[model samples]
Target: MTFEHAKCPLCLDQIAERSRLPDRGYQYQCPACGGPFEVSALAQRRAGKVGIHPGARAKMQQHLLDGKRPRVVFVNTTPNSYYEVREVNASEQTIIN
Candidate 1:
């Protein structure tokens, strides 16, 4: 998490760069997946093993097509690992979790 860079957590694709968010997570675009996503530092470390559902990925794509960023909150704690996908307005700040 202290690292300045990271890869896409869902696809293992390289994230050329990442920006820190208010929640302490990072956001970056995945070249392979062709979209932007946010993940907590812990989820980033877990990589694809963090368990982002296929449906969430689908929603992300939809958000892109709608000119929005999928606000993905990856809660990867034991006993309740899950994804909470939301729509983000471009003009609004992304509150990543």
Candidate 2:
């Protein structure tokens, strides 16, 4: 398996390979500070153009009290095309069409 390295924006430490989740937009969790961050390809390209940092992380937890977990579409455009629904977590009820 291959690995990609990126600096943790919060701790400024190089994140280890085990902490990366490539499929989910190159998301990573810093081992030192436990901060969640993403190093997106588009952001890298823009950073190359603008000469800025290429990664972003959630703000401090106290600042996230009003934030909501994004609703993700689990199933859409099925063979029958009868319904579309989103979910925030597994325990939540499924909103039907």
Candidate 3:
């Protein structure tokens, strides 16, 4: 949510050294005291964890049917190998390679 300057947990000084910066969470050391500083996810609302936006899922499905499948699907980096939708009455199946 909010990104503050990296602070040392022990002393609360802005960490200027490149090596001491935290990669993700706010858990770095205070330059003054060498104590660990931590950023809390609870301090802010996480993005997209609540639920999909209204009509987003339907639009995504429509886009997929239109052959605009994204390179990566779901939580994985692997591409979707295939996709198909069948019309029961027409007895037809459409496959996208």
Candidate 4:
């Protein structure tokens, strides 16, 4: 078996694949600070500072089910634009958003 690892930007802890959901997008919780984060293999980016609140996580999951990409939004700023979400494998690197 193989595992993917990422650093929790909030708690600065190393999160192992065991802590993540085994679905298409890797959703994980930081063991140290209990922060929620996601790594999108399609986007090839990690979204940090996502809320650990139940409602937030639910909303994110809903978006994923609806074929939307969930992005971490910071204070005092908003996403410039929205793009259609599409699934891409590791072998493909073209991203529209």
Q: For every candidate structure, what is the RMSD over all alpha carbons to the true structure, in angstroms?
A: 4.8, 11.9, 21.2, 10.0
Q: Give a tens-digit lDDT track for model 4, residues 1-97.
A: 2345666433345563323334444544445533333445432232333323344445555555565545332223265422222333334322321
Indicate the TM-score of model 1: 0.59
Candidate 4, TM-score vs. the true structure?
0.30
- Which lDDT values do the candidates have, in the order given? 0.62, 0.34, 0.28, 0.40
Candidate 4 overall Cα lDDT vs. reference?
0.40
User: What stretches of model 2 exceed 4 Å from their correct place?
Assistant: 18-24, 47-97
| lDDT for position 34 in model 3 | 32
lDDT of 4 at 20: 33
What are the models' TM-scores?
A: 0.59, 0.34, 0.23, 0.30
**Model 1 lDDT, residue 81, Cα:** 75
lDDT of residue 45 for candidate 4 = 38
Q: TM-score winner among the candidates?
A: 1
| Candidates sorted on TM-score, descending | 1, 2, 4, 3
Show where candidate 4 strays beyond 4 Å: 1-4, 7-51, 74-97
Model 3: per-residue lDDT, tens digit, 1-97?
A: 2234543322224562212112322333234433232222321112124332223334433534554431111221366322222212222222211
lDDT of 1 by residue, 9-79 (tens): 55655664567776646777666665666656655554555456777767766776676776666676788
Model 2 TM-score is 0.34
Model 4 lDDT-worst window of ten? 81-90
Candidate 2: the clashing residue pairs are: none
Best lDDT among the predictions, by candidate number: 1
- Comparing candidate 1 with candidate 4, which one achieves the higher lDDT? 1
By TM-score, the better pick of 3 and 4 is: 4
